[model samples]
Target: MGIEREIKLALPPEQADAADRFFSGIAGTPGRDVPLVNIYFDTPALALAGQKVALRLRKTPDGWLQTLKAAGSVQGGLHSRHEWETSVPGEALDFVALEHACDDAAALAALRAAASELGERFRTAFVRRLWQFEFDGARIEAAIDRGEVTAQVSGQTRREAISEIELELLRGEEPALHALTVRLSAAVAGLTPEDINKAQRGYRLCAQ
Candidate 1:
């Protein structure tokens, strides 16, 4: 039960450009441009009603990943959290090196560019803070992450009571994040290949 965690403040949807400046000073991971998709899942209106809570599934060439991000209350103030994430190649869970720097600049640009290509469906529709989690299991490898997601609207809205559980694995000093990623790619689904990164891939830059 090894899980890694990171948290960041979120810029409003219209102010997403802040992420570009925020990451510019930090990220340095390497990769070619690719296609990406962000999908948000909603609970029954009856469950959350006038509140904000959603499950976001992001699909890219690497594969598909899921996040539990919602506008709600918790131990902290009113902050959103990413409960779980799934990787296809399974090797992505341990790849935290790029994540920290990606939280910086170059990474922000990639996400912004990807989001732009995604168009209105995913544009500055909504914004929430970001929280990331990684988990590895002896029997299986898995993870849970939290990021911004969109609100929901339905033709015939129904309501239900619901709460979700998320999991994540962090590759610490010994195993290394990259090694953990490989392990997680096993039990999860809807993840792609490119999401994987080396343990220190972004270290040099992120440390700055």
Candidate 2:
């Protein structure tokens, strides 16, 4: 398991191009656009949600990956969470592999309890423009995600747009995330800190 430290910021859809230009100018190259399809799963009773745990299978250019994220705190858009991720052969989730990858006892127990009853609850499809660079002695990954979250409940479909910037500390002090966020916020107006993650949004959609 690894501690995923990142700062999430909400960006206005209209300002996406400007943000892209800003990152390109600073990084000295254009960002790479990666199309991603993410499906979130939970028990029908939402036991995982109640425990504040999130599980998802993501389809990337490289291959499929399953991730388990445990309950964590989000303060001022800075999210600190325990994450266990591993590559899978297909869209299906591998609970055995996930259990082995997970180091947190609570998270492991939660996965075991929910594994049998788990099913797809919602999905997020987005194109992530990624940029990696060294800033202030820190290796940071900046991503601009543009897409929407969708869920089907009671024979109806619900949707929400996802336009945000994520500044993650790949290897460095946490302060670097804030510094990069500050620079991006200043460069792109209307960028505000977002405390809610995509999983939370998916759960809320299911509730509605």
Candidate 3:
């Protein structure tokens, strides 16, 4: 288990090109675009969500990974959460591995109880443009994600656009994360701090 700290920002659709250019200029190279497909799971009653836990299987260029994120806190667009992630053999979820990785007793029990009933709730598909750099004695990964969140409910489909910047602290003082956001915010217009995460967005789509 690890504490995931990051700041999320909502980017207007129109500013995507400008954001790309800004990052490219700083990195001295174009950001790498990675297409990612993530399928979130939960029980019929959304028990996990009620517990503020989120589970998902993500397909990345490297391979499939299963992640379980427990509720943390979001303050001023900065999110701090407990995350457990592990690579799986294939598309299916490996609950055993997840249980082994989990250190929190309550979260582990919840995972065990929900394993049998878990099913796909919603999905997010997007291309993430990634850049890694150093700032103020800190290492950070900046991702510009563009795509949509989709869900099927009552024979109807719900969709929402995904255009956001995620600044994840790889290593360094937490304050540096905020400093970088301030720098980016000034250069990029229409950048608003976002407190809602993709999983939350997925759950909301399911409700509509």
Q: What are the lDDT figures for the candidates, one per model?
A: 0.29, 0.94, 0.93
What candidate 3 gets wrong by more than 4 Å, as runs, is: none
For candidate 1, write residues 1-208 as lDDT tens digits: 1123321122233333333232222223221233434543222222221233233355666676644333333221112233334453432222242233233343233333333222211211111222233323222122122232222233332222111111222333323333444433332332333221111112112222
* lDDT (tens digit, per residue) of candidate 2 on 70-139: 9999999999999999999999999889989999999888888988999999999999999998998899
Better of 1 and 2 by lDDT: 2
* Model 3 lDDT at residue 100: 90
Number of clashes in every candidate structure?
Answer: 31, 0, 0
Q: How far is candidate 1 from the true structure (C-alpha RMSD, Å)?
A: 18.7
RMSD (CA, Å), each prediction: 18.7, 0.7, 0.8
RMSD of 2: 0.7
